[model samples]
Target: MRYDGSNELHARQARAKLEKLIKDKKIFDLTEKKPQRSIQANKYLHVCLSYFGCQIGETMEYVKRNYYKILCNPDTFIREREDKYLGRVKYLRSSSELDSSEFSLTVDRFRNWCSSNAGVYIPSPDEERLIQLMELEIERNKEFI
Candidate 1:
């Protein structure tokens, strides 16, 4: 059974059920949930991505789809075929599902991949000047959004 902890009442009910199950000696594994990436992390990631995309004369969407989504995290893509058309399709798992550490690793991989393969050195958020310039450039372009 899948347990959702978003709802207070449901979470309490699920905990009670789990306690009873434990008492009944049913084997189970329980793990604590990790925090997801913060808003600042997300913003920094996008800023770097948009900057790199602009440098390469590509749209942010194009860079995100090809470079970050496909390359850095290929495992998240699910392949399926349509029964009626028999055409293959792919669905990407949302990055929002990733925990803070997982998201940070993914971002690091993207940065490394960009530098090694694309020869584009994306500045870190710590490089405040470059980051601000990139943000301004993206704002001017409008397509970076």
Candidate 2:
């Protein structure tokens, strides 16, 4: 199935919700154990690597080669990837909010590239769980808020 506008819309909505939760400080209580920055970064990297059809070894190699660059300036890495793999889409803006069409195009291109180059399909479960876990965490912390 091709990525479409609806998918982009949904992703934006979910991202907005998460951002709102974060802004409201409703997702985590300071008194409790908080999610680690490394964990969050790893989860995000996993999702991005999955989109690119990078297996564990490939992902590790990518991190090894680009970790410092990513840490120092993530937008550069994102822009490089977009320029390399997604010519059809406009460059990603620094703003957190993404244009739906651009987002859809990025996803489509990544999936297509991954399938053709790596012979691997994107697995939905991990991405789904990642979002779900955030939502659940927010829900669980609602009372504290």
lDDT of each: 0.79, 0.44
lDDT of 1 by residue, 35-98 (tens): 8678999899888778878878888877788888888768654445565575676677667778
| Model 2 clash tally, residue pairs | 0
Weakest 10 consecutive residues of candidate 2 by summed lDDT = 28-37
Give the TM-score (vs. native) of candidate 1: 0.66
Across residues 95-132, which tens digit of lDDT does each residue of candidate 2 receive? 12334444334445544555576675544435776555
TM-score of every candidate relative to the true structure: 0.66, 0.30
The CA lDDT at 74 in model 1 is: 82
What would you estimate as the lDDT of candidate 1?
0.79
In angstroms, what RMSD does candidate 1 have relative to the true structure? Answer: 6.4
Model 2 TM-score? 0.30
Error of 2 at 4 (Å): 26
Regions more than 4 Å wrong, model 1: 1-33, 76-89, 143-145
For model 2, what is the alpha-carbon lDDT of residue 34?
A: 26
Give residue 132's error in model 1 in angstroms.
Answer: 1.3
